[model samples]
Target: MTITIPTGDLVGVLSDVVNFAHPKPDGGVLNCVRLNWDGEYLHATATDRIRAGISTWHKDDEPDDDGQDDLFSNWGGADNPWSILMPLDDAKDVISNYKLGPKEYRVPLTIDLHQGVLKIERSRDTGHSRLVMQIQGVLEEFPDVREILANNDRVKPVTGQLYTAKFLADFAKVRARGPLQLAFAEGLTHITIGKRFVGAIAPLPEDRAAA
Candidate 1:
C-alpha cells in the first residue's frame, strides 16, 4: 500500500515518537516504531514498557476513481489495521534533512510498503530524494496503548508534579508550539500539546520524609 502525508506533519510526529523509544534490556520490540493505517487515519507509536508516545493523522478527504471517499480502501479493514515495524534509525532517516521548498505549497512524502520493504520518497520541482529500508521481520507484538489511554478516568482531579528539567527541555524541542497540558495518573505522566500529539513518561518516585 502507498501512503502519502505532508512533510511537516510526518516530521513532527516522527520526532515525538523517536524520543520515547527505549528498548527493553531483555531484548524486546520497544526499540522500533509501529506504523499503522486503519483505512482512515495513520498512526505512529513507540514505547519502552514504561513510557509511550502516539501520534495520529487523518487522511485527507480525496475521492478515488470510483468516487470512493477513502484513499486506503484496499489497505485493510478498520478492525484489522495494517502495520509495519520500522527500526529506530531507519525511521529517523526517513524524515531527516527534509525541508519544504519556498514555493512548495504542500510537499508530500510517500511511503510504499511492499514485499517486506518500505520505500520513502520526497520530490519537488527543484530536487528529489528517496530511501528504501527493510521492515523488522520479528512480529514482537505492541501493546494496545490507545486502549489504555482511553480507559483512564479524567473526572478525578490530578495533581501537578515537577518533571525532570532535562525532560522538560527535550519535550519543548519537539512539542507543537502552543499551550501544553500535563496529567499524572497510575504512575505515568502524560504530556499533550494538542490532539495530534501525545507522550507518556514515568513520573519520578515520591520523596520519603527524613527520619
Candidate 2:
C-alpha cells in the first residue's frame, strides 16, 4: 500500500508539539531525539517545538517496507556531527547549521527498530539538515491535549482603562529560569520588564476581556 497526502497535511500535524530546543554536544549519550512518522509513503512530520515546520518532497503514496531504504537514501550524504546518537549534545549544532528553503525540496524519514534509532533528513545541492533521534523513550500524550492546543490562541482581552504597567516600579514580581513561567497577572495583560516583576499592560483590542 502507498501512503500519500498533500504537503499541507503535515503542517497541521507538525504544529502539535515542538518543545525541544536544539541539541548540545557532550561526551555523554544522546538525550534528545528527532522523531518522524512515516505512513509508509504519504508524508513525514517532526518538530523542535520552540519552532516547528514540515517538509514534503516529490514522492508517491504507497506503503512500502523500505522505511530503512528511505533512511539510507536520505542520511547517506550529509555533514553531520561525529556522534550519531547524542542529540542532546549535538542538537544545537544541527539546527544552527542545517540549511533548508531556497528551492524545491524533499526529505525522508527512517525508523530503525533493530538499531533503536530514528532520523529525518533533507538534502540540498549544497548541504543537508538531519536529525538522528530515538524511538519510544519519550511520551507526551495527554488526555486534554485539545486544551493545550486551544491555549495558544483563545486568550480573552483585558478590559477597562488600559495602561502599560512596568515591573517593580508598579507591581509584584518573581524570577525563574524558563520562558512563559514569569507571568504578569491581576489585570487584562501582564507585562514584565526584567526581574522587577508584577507589570501589567492593557490587553490588546482582540484580547480585551468583557467589562
Candidate 3:
C-alpha cells in the first residue's frame, strides 16, 4: 500500500518525534519513532520512557473519478494496524532532504512499507527522489502512551513537581502556536496542545522534588 503525507504535516510530526526520542544507556530501540499508518490516519509516537508524544495526520482524500485503487482499501482494522519503527535520524533526513516543487501548493510524500523497511518517495514536475530506510520490527513496543495521556485529565490543576525543565521548555517550543496545558497527577506531568497532540513527562524523584 502507498501512503501519502503532506510535506508540512510530515515535517511537523517527525520534528516532534525526534525531539522527544530519548537515548538509552543500554543502546536499544527507545531512540526510534513508531509510525502506524492505519489507512486513514498516520500516527507518529516517540518516548524516552520518561516522556512521550503522539502526533497524527489524516491522509489526503482522493477524487471519486480517479480510477486508482483505494490506498486504504486493504487496511486491516485498528486491531491489526501496519506499523514500522524507524530510527529518528533516518526519519529526519528523509523529510529534510525531500524537494518540493516550485508550483506545487502542497508537497505530498509517498511511503511504501514492506519487509520491515520504509521506502519514502517524493516527486514533482521539477524532479523526484526516493529514500529507503530500515525499520526495527515491533521488538520493544512503545509504552502504552495513549492510555497514559487519557488517564491524565487536562482540566485539573497541575500539581506535580517539574522534573526536566529543559524537556518541558522544548516541548512547549514545538507546539508554541497553540495554547498549551500542563497537568500533573500520579507522579506524571501531562502536556497537551490543542486537541490533537498530547505528551507525558515523569516527575522527579521525591528527594529531587523536595529539593
Candidate 4:
C-alpha cells in the first residue's frame, strides 16, 4: 500500500512527536513513533513511559478508489485504520534526509508498505526520486495511549502531581511558534503547542520531584 502526504506536513508531524520517544536502546516499542492513518488524518505519537507527544495532519480530500492504486482501499477507514510502529532511528532519518537537499517543500512524500518493509520516498519529477529511506516496521503492539489520554479530563484537575523541570522542558521542543499552553490533572500533564501538536507527561512522585 502507498500513502501520499505533503512533505512539510509529514516532516512537521514527525518532528513534533519524535523527541518524546524513548531515548534508550532497551526501550523496545517505546523507542518508536506510532503512525496512524484514520481515513482523513495522519496521527503520529511517541512515548517514553513518562511522557508522550502526539501530532495530527489532516488530508482534506477524500481519496477516490480506482481499484489498484486507491490509497483508501487497504486502510484509512473507520473500521480499518492503518497503523504501524516505526523505529525511532527510521523516523529521525526521514526528518534529517528531508532537510538535507534543496528545499522543495511542495513535493509530496510517498510511503509504501509491503511484506513487512516500509519505504518512504520523495520525488523531484515523475520518474526521478529525490530522497528515499526504508526500514522494517516494529512487530510489537504499541500501547493504547489514546485510552490514557481519553481518561483524563482536560478542563478539570483531578489530582496534583509534581514534575521535574528538566523533563518538563521536553514539551518545549515542539515546533510551535506561539506560546505553549499547559494544563494539569491527577497524574498527567497535558501540553498543547501551537494548534496541531499535543503532549502528555506523567509526573514524578512528590519526593522524587523534590529531589
TM-score of each: 0.73, 0.28, 0.75, 0.79
lDDT of each: 0.62, 0.29, 0.64, 0.73
Number of the top candidate by lDDT? 4
lDDT tens string, model 4, 63-170?
A: 122222334323232423567789999899888877532344434677766666778877665234577888788999898777887787456554456776867877
The window of 10 residues in a row where model 2 has the poorest summed lDDT is: 76-85
Question: Model 2 off-target regions past 4 Å?
Answer: 1-90, 96-101, 107-116, 120-147, 151-155, 159-211
Q: What is candidate 2's lDDT per residue for 1-211, written digit by digit as tens?
A: 1122221222212221122222342412223433333333221222232222222222342221222223234331222211112243333343333323323123333333333333332334223444443323333321221232334443444334433344222222222212332232332343332321122233334344333
Instruction: Name the runs in model 4 displaced over 4 angstroms.
Output: 60-80, 100-103, 126-129, 154-161, 177-179, 209-211
Supply the global lDDT for candidate 2.
0.29
Query: What local lDDT score does residue 47 receive in model 1, on the 0 to 100 scale?
Result: 78
User: What's each prediction's clash count?
Assistant: 0, 22, 0, 1
**Better-scoring candidate (lDDT), 1 or 4:** 4
lDDT-best of 1 and 2: 1
Count of clashes in candidate 3: 0
The residue-by-residue lDDT of candidate 3 on 1-211, one tens digit each, is: 5666655556667766677887643436777788888767778898887888887766443312333333433322233357888776776675567634333324555677777767765554323454444444555666667886777645446445747778766686553435787777665777877655778888779788778
Residues 121-211 of candidate 1 have per-residue lDDT tens digits of: 6644324555344444336777777777766525345555555666556567555644677776666677787667677666566672111
- lDDT at residue 50 of model 1 (Cα atoms): 56
Give the range where candidate 3 is weakest over 10 consecutive residues by summed lDDT. 61-70
